[model samples]
Target: MTEEIEQFETVLGFQIPEPLRTVHNVHRWTRLGNSDEESIRSIIARYIEYRRAIGTDDLDLLRTFRNNGNVECIIQYLRQSIRPMVVNTLDNSVVLICQPGGTDFHALASLFTSRQLIMFYAMLGEYFFQQVITQEEISGRESGVTIVYDLENFKITDYLNPYSPIMQIFRIGIALLQEYYLELLRNLLVINSGPIVRVFLQLAKVILLPKAFEKIRIISSSNMKERLLELVSSAALPSAYGGCWTEVDVENVNPLTCCTIRRPIEGKAPPCNIEAAEHVNLSAGKSYSAKISATKGQTLRWIVKTSGKTEFAVTLYDSKGKGEAELLIPRLTIATPLPDKVPEVGSVECKDTGVYGLEFRNVNSSFFSLKIRYGWVLE
Candidate 1:
């Protein structure tokens, strides 16, 4: 309210519309992650510049949202269930939600228009900036948000045709965030999928933008929850989805404040760590390799204990070039005997000694930790 346009005059090095001053809470909450007055002003200026480039004027949205305040039904949607839960991690908080089965998108869109949708995102942006981003910034690291969409019972609907109005509205909402908000979304996780998920993805591939499409992870139901556990702790997830949150969550109970995330669990059992080896985090779509010099025929023995159904390949090569060396062990995706047990081990002799290359690659899109140990011995 303190002459926001004037404050941003020099920060943005451009002229801002005077009508933007009438927007409610427009100036406030802009500095959720910023500490000083200049910092917040700079953030607003950058946002305005980006929006202008993307052909989305926030002034129009703010002007439209100022008139509608009857959000009783929208409030119900926010608190209908323990949804859109924030899972606090080392990097930042991930907004996780279990999509309601058999959704009524049409009725909801009718109740909430584009104006209301704009206000909704504004509120969410403020909350995320204040609660998650600011905290990470204070700790000397840039913050980001990961959104998880649990597609457990998603139904293939005619309402979700390629060019439907509902999908258009959804795309608009996504576009608003992508264009206006910078460096906000870290990743989008889609799990607990079924047959309908394939159809949805097929359609989405054609409609979605390249950046948004790249962020999507269509995980298998077998290892879906396990993949989510890596991004968000098990304590942050619902008990029904291998987390610690119980049926009755009291007012004081919050994953960020009260929930202590220790490890992943299934039903009433402990985590999947069969062999007590050293745990190492595996990055998705990246290959991890280690070189060990082998003299004559030193046997290379290794054992890997994974957390869940993580597809990984173990390859041992004597050299690294077109002329392939003796394949000590061909790359094979390690399979878990059962969903509960995840322990795999293999040993291959190094036929020759010139810098033997041992590579371990994560074949999945989601991150999974591995408890691995290896050694070289005389055979």
Candidate 2:
């Protein structure tokens, strides 16, 4: 395999980096069944060019984003703007599970440009490659990753139309994975597929390479557990999918958490002591507000869990003492906390010196008062 890689490099007149030098990595090209050396060389060249084009070739910058709070605001923004997707790495496989039906696709489209989304994905890809693929290679195991897409309730309408903004984002994500990270994928398993999912797969066929499309399997919900157990261990699989592990178990094993670094402390002694959780009882149709003064570049971080659905918003008052207000976070209904689930975590860097107001409105029509336990820190 090494000799073949050397021969390919000599013919192509380019050095293949250490990251792509493994036997399994090189074999991934042949898996495409394009036996022609010139065609394979062109594909490899294109892959390398795409990586450089996205600035993912700079490992240090990617690492900075992974371990620092510099991009914490953007990370939180992306999470709140879109449907949450969980990236779980178990052994040689990475499972990507999408939350069921919470995201507003149109709102997400208007929130960010295609370039911003691609850059975010680039960071995630680099992290997965360094943490998952590199570790596997060092252990003398095959370097390829088996990718599983758990699309139980994923809506096809948001992604099927080519003209839709969500579809545009979908294409960008798929193109990035196919063009730059194709070699890392061993096989793609898509569980909990229905008739609508089959229709979506037909669209996927048009976008994916023929060889790559052939590697996808659509498993029904009935046999999903049995089929997944063949690829993932019960210890690694989520309990929702007939496995023994809980959501917390899955979170603990994820490698991407390192990318969402917590707020840093300056000295051994705490900069500001942790505040006690403030309890608020909001009556129906009433709103609660908490104001804090902040300067530019400071981050406002909060953790809140609500007893019922509530609308939360953040406003920035101008430093000039004018009554003008800028809605930092528009009023949006927050999901009620589930048993043992993590609280809603959010953070945004202050762009101007102002008195920031955090408001919570009881959006529910029910007569019962909404209970909220929340805490905030400006760092």
Candidate with the greatest TM-score versus the true structure: 2
What does candidate 1's lDDT look like per residue over 1-379, in tens digits? 3576556555546555543342222333243324465666665665554334323343332223222243223433432223333454634555545453445554444444333444455444434444343444345444556666666555656546635434645555555555445345567677766778877787667666666678777767787667667766765566655666554554423343232222221132123323334445566655666666666577755445443323333344535565754444433333332223323444556655666555555655765544334233334
TM-score of each candidate structure, all chains considered together: 0.46, 0.55
For lDDT, the strongest prediction is 2
**Candidate 1 off by > 4 Å:** 1-72, 78-85, 98-100, 246-379
State the lDDT of candidate 2 residue by residue for 1-379, as single tens digits: 6798887677767888767676666666665425676767777776665555444565654246534333343354322111122223345554443332334554444444333444566555655555445555656665554555655556766666775654655565566666656666656778766767768688879888776788787777778888777776665456666555443332223232111212222222112233437889998999988898998999998766677666676778765567676666534455422312335556678998879988899975678799887778999
lDDT, candidate 2, at 76: 47
Model 1 TM-score is 0.46
Cα miss at 49, model 1 (Å)?
Answer: 8.8
Residue-level error in angstroms, candidate 2, position 164: 1.3
Clashing pairs in 1: none
Residue 128 accuracy (lDDT) in model 2: 53
What are the lDDT scores of the predictions, listed in order?
Answer: 0.48, 0.59
